[model samples]
Target: MRRTSSKYVRHSDEGELLWLRPPTRSGHVFIKVDPTNTSSARMAMGTQQVEVGGRIPVHRHDSQDEILFVYAGQGTVIVGDERAQFKAGTTVFIPQGVWHGVENTSDEPLQVVWVVSPPGLEAMFRDIGTPPGEEAKSLTPEEFAAVAERHGMRVKSH
Candidate 1:
């Protein structure tokens, strides 16, 4: 029932990193893949690098399911009421509307590749994150909520 866009391909090494700082949390550098540049309208994928001791805040996507694959380093992933240890090669599946977050627990950088269905979150990252080579900028809670809401997601309260 839907028309697909032309085929597209991008190498990870050639992607640009954006500094993403969610409200009241440490930021990570992310290489986001633009949905508009791809053929599928229902998927988005990219990688992120979190420095030691950094974490992405608790959040939920209202309309999209997510998969996070740990590419390197150690960390913990909190999903709903469960917590699990993650390391290189760990893969996590987060259903839509589930509360989830990630924390880098090791002394080295944590790298993860993430995919979201019904692609849109990458656009939110572009809207909220700072461009490469620029310092990361912090957002107020209200501002963060607004941005996330625009992309069909919400920042969960701690």
Candidate 2:
């Protein structure tokens, strides 16, 4: 028998990132729809919205694999060596350690839903004295390096 998690949390993610909490310097408005709890899979699924003319900083998930589905509007997804324009129905796969970023160019918001397998980013926040569903802030160059090293993340200045 499988036991469901005892608690379910819900909150606004970021200031710019809206769905999570304190938005970050990258404007990552994200929402974790299915967290790492006892849900469908041992993964984290989320919806992402990019405000008009806004974009996220380039970064990579060094540990988990990710798949993103563009559901609305138009935008550019920079993945590793290439930047691709995406729209409704475009699905992109991001392997672990591949640099990726998103931008919204349309007058409307760019909407996307993504899945991150083997969820553990929650613990990442714990280690940094931050929390999920909170605005993501920009760290100093040194600070960014430290966190990147700690989380196995690769930050690409773009």
Top-scoring candidate (TM-score): 1
> Per-prediction count of colliding residue pairs?
0, 18
Global fold similarity of model 1 (TM-score): 0.86
**Candidate 1 residue runs with Cα over 4 Å from true position:** 1-8, 22-32
Clashes of 1: 0
The weakest ten consecutive residues by lDDT in model 2 span: 14-23
Find the number of clashing residue pairs for candidate 2: 18
User: For model 2, how does the per-residue alpha-carbon lDDT over 87-143 read when each residue is reduced to its tens digit?
Assistant: 899999999888888878788978777777767543444343333455445457557
Give residue 138's error in model 1 in angstroms: 2.2
Model 1 C-alpha lDDT per residue in residues 64-105, reported as the tens digit of each score: 999999999998999999999989999999999999999999
Model 1, position 56: C-alpha lDDT score: 80
- What is the TM-score (0 to 1) of candidate 2? 0.65
